[model samples]
Target: MAQSIYLGLMSGTSFDGVDGVAVQFVPGQPLQVLAASARSFEPALREALFALQTPGHNEIEREAQIANQLAHDYALTTNELLQQAALKPSQVQALGVHGQTIRHQPTLGYTRQINNPARLAELTSIDVVADFRSRDIAAGGQGAPLVCAFHAVQFGAPDETRVICNIGGISNITILAAEETTGGFDCGPGNALLDYWANLHLGTPYDTNGCFALSGKVNENLLHTLLAGHYFALPPPKSTGRELFNSAWLNIRLEKFDTLPPQDVQATLTALTAHSIARAIAQFASRCQAIYVCGGGARNPALMQMLGAALSTAGLAHATLSTTDTLGVPAQQVEACAFAWLAMRCVTRAPGNLPSVTGAAGPRVLGALYPR
Candidate 1:
């Protein structure tokens, strides 16, 4: 039997960069991470992609250009990882590229992740698995937070309940409790609001260690207001993005506190992220015994502190808080490896979406394959 190796690529909600991972998964065996790389989009392109996430005029042409550039950039990173791994295109099974999610409206029955799979396949000379969300959406699923299945597979504990959290531009969690069906959903904003607020004031992309936010105190009123978002109130099997929580949304809420210090507002946003996730965990997975965080937010210490504080106050003070790295997978590589796992599943004709997690009609083999 040949080794089953798949390359996974992910450009998360933050649009900060694409994380490419190459892994080999032999059936019934632990997957091995072979190589990984991170490639960032140029600032101008990043802004354009961010703009397209929301409504605006003259978007069609701009979006097309952006998609092409994204594919080109994805190929660049994929090629680099392949070279570093010293593997030929033929040796790898396929590439799973989660294109930039410009819009995800599963309720209305459509989700858009803009990536030219055909072009990517042509450039990489490898089979491509893309559009991993639409099929699940068609089956009445939220079609977001698609990585929970991967989390359940990689991090599920036999004795203790484990919560796997990926905090990108948006935040989400996977609850893997022993003997209980694994489940997860988008908790809320992860770094989106904080980054927006920081750029608007500190002129940086994200809060390093949540320093700006640490400098200010959380405004109880603003925290309360931000928590009132309708999406947060939705039941499980739900997902969200910049569509509901972005700079514009933040700006609208900020108008009332025009005189508030920028750092205070940033602090409030960070708290909103922490409070929302902690609240979700408490409400959905009260039995959670440990939390393993991943993605960009794991690097933010102040935010982690707030999460710990919130969780401790909720009477779960003994639950351990840490990143996925403690479990062998690096924080940033988990999502990328997830896409790789999804690609391998698709190639093997295995189901990807967990009906219980996404509220889909049934389990389905997610992602459309574009052959090279």
Candidate 2:
């Protein structure tokens, strides 16, 4: 039998960069991470892509052009990673490309992510699995938190309950029970508000280790007001993005805090991220034995400290992917690797969508395949 390897490419909600991970899978064996690489998006491309997230008046033709450009950029990213891994296109089974997410209003039964797989496949000369969300949406699912399946495979334990929390632009937690039942839902905003405030006040992409936030003090009044949002009060089996918690949304919350300092606001926003995530875990996953943190937010020391404090207060244990003793292909590479695993599942006609996580009607196969 031949070895099966798949490349997973992902551009997360952070709009920061593209990440690709190559993995090899053998029958009845654990998947092995072969190679991984991440490339930051160029300023121009990033700006164009970010602008599309807003409710702007843009032409359909322009959107189409941007989609093609994104696909090209994704192909370039894939080619670079493949070269760095020293693997030929033929050595890989297929490419799982999660195109940039511009809009993900699954409630309306449609989600738009740029990057045409056919164009990408033609450009990269590899079979492509793209559009991983639509099928789940079609099946009355939110088409999100798809990582739960991958988390179930990698982090699930036979005798213990575990939760994997991914803090990207938004935060989502996957709960794996001792009985092997899995559940997940969007907790709330992760770094999106913090980054927005930092860019506006500090002129930086993010708060390094929550340093800027640490310089100030959290505003309890403001934090309370921010937490009052309806999304935070909602139950599980839900997902969210910049659509509900972006600059505009933040500005609305800021309207009430006329006396708060900008730096203090940054501090409060960071607190909000940590508090909201921790609150969700406490409320929904208190019984879980451990929580493994991932994504860019995991790198922030201040946030980590806050998480630890919050978890301790809740009488829950604080943990991270790092505590597992291996980089395991790095925090940044986990989601990209997930898409690769999803693509592999798609090729095999295996069910990739988790019904309990996404509130989908039931388990379903994920992704649309585009041939080279």
Candidate 3:
């Protein structure tokens, strides 16, 4: 196969910002990241997005406006990526953009990502690939953890089992077993709840290096309450988003601990993420030798420390944990690159979803193309 350049744009469930990358993929060689750029969502836009996570009045109009706004943000970031890479729109093959997902409910046979791909294409003057999840949902799959297929290509080991744990707003693990097919699913809440609490108590977008969490101790009672959620115990081929683990959900669970110290709550939330992820690894990828983490959660030292302890408790004491930066990809950029890889597959007419990972009826090409 010949080499081609594709740009990828992503705004994860964290609703924090847009991350864009210009990447070149060549046959038999590791993919090269030409350029990367990130732009945070303005406070107003971020609030609007968080509000839309739940049902609200005038949602159709609100969501449409937000989609338009998101396309503009995506285009701006894409332009920055292109400029940084010293490439023009005409030189790029296409853009793979994963829009802001407002609701991910594959069980209900629908998933919604707010995006205006045509507008993005018009703004950027390049072919655009968007709406990557619905097709998998149509095929009876979770329509998520889509990054696992990309993980298998970029991080898989032939002689040893590896786990790629991506902790975005929601945490998910991709199991790349040396002797078995790849598997993954949403493990549980990631930075979403932690960030929410941080924003609420500290007036910051996220806890810097988990300092708020490190200042307190994990309350086992609250931790037990969190672990008892039905989602954590569900088998694989399942996924979740803010739809289930949002502020409202956390508030309800916090009613019993109203007098609990805010810092303790933060700490428990961090532990919740660590324990849930550790449980998933133990249950599905018990034999995994090393776990390479990606996404925003990798930056949190407290969370990482908690994860290490949680792993020891889960009987995965021998498993080592580290960030994907050691694997030639920055934690924040893996998902963006994954979508770029996915877009390449779509452009080549190859299947993108792995039936084993997503429980899709079969592999399916996963994106909608909008030509410039």
Query: How many steric overlaps are in each model, in order?
Result: 0, 0, 0
| Model 1 stretches astray by more than 4 angstroms | none
**TM-score, per-candidate, Cα-based:** 0.98, 0.95, 0.99
Task: Assess the local accuracy of residue 355 in candidate 2 as a C-alpha lDDT between 0 and 100.
Answer: 91
Scored by lDDT, model 3 comes in at 0.94
lDDT of 1 by residue, 1-372 (tens): 257889999998898989999999877767789999999889998999988987799999888989899999999999998999999999888999999999988889999999889999999999999999999999999997889999988898799899998999999999999899988999989999888888888888888889999999999998898899888999988999888888778888888899999889988998898889888888888888999999999999989999898887666687899999999999999999999999988998899998888999999999999998
lDDT of every model, 2 decimals: 0.91, 0.83, 0.94
The alpha-carbon deviation from the true structure for residue 69 of candidate 3, after best TM-score superposition, in angstroms, is 0.7
lDDT of 1: 0.91
* Error of model 1, residue 309, in angstroms: 0.6
Instruction: Tell me the tens digit of each residue's lDDT in model 2 across 278-371.
Output: 7888888778777778888988887878777767766675433232224254677789889999999999999999998888898899988888
Relative to the true structure, candidate 2 reaches a TM of: 0.95
Lowest-lDDT window of 10 residues in candidate 2? 318-327
Largest TM-score belongs to which candidate?
Answer: 3
Identify the runs in model 2 with alpha carbons over 4 angstroms from their true place. Answer: 317-329
Ranking by lDDT: 3, 1, 2
What is the Cα root-mean-square deviation between model 3 and the actual structure? Answer: 0.8
Candidate 3: tens digits of C-alpha lDDT, residues 1-372: 699999988899999999888999999888899999989999999999998988999999999999999999999999899899999999999999999999998999999999999999999999999999999999999999899999999988788799999999999999998778899999999999999999999999999999999999899999999999999988888999998998889999999999999999999999999999999999988998999999999999999999999999999999988999988999989999999999999999998998887889999999999998
